[model samples]
Target: MYPLDEAARAIVPNLRGAIDIPNCGHWTQQEHPELVNTALLEFLKGL
Candidate 1:
């Protein structure tokens, strides 16, 4: 999916802002919950 994502972005740069939450597959949030939380918090703070 990462490679496919890259190819899609290459063809359609406008979709680069998309956030692909690969929850089921190697779930980054579950694997690294603290990291994910920190990033989320920071993003919200920015907004």
Candidate 2:
């Protein structure tokens, strides 16, 4: 939350959607690779 709080605040034009992944901490791609991959696929498909 600390590292991402500032980034979260910048939500005017550039940023689109934000996903708060659970069951994982900072290292999301490393700690939860499968979950990250699945989420990425779904998001890409939407576009």
Which candidate gets the maximum lDDT versus the true structure? 2
- Give one digit per residue, the lDDT tens place, for model 2 in 1-47: 34675667676555546677767789999998988899899888988
At residue 47, give the lDDT of candidate 2.
Answer: 83
Residue 5 error, candidate 1, Å? 11
Residue pair clashes in candidate 1: none
Model 2: pairs clashing at backbone N, Cα or C within 3 Å? none
Once fitted onto the true fold, the runs of candidate 1 whose alpha carbons sit more than 4 angstroms away are 1-25
- Compute the lDDT for candidate 2: 0.76
Cα lDDT, all candidates: 0.68, 0.76
Error of 1 at 44 (Å): 0.1
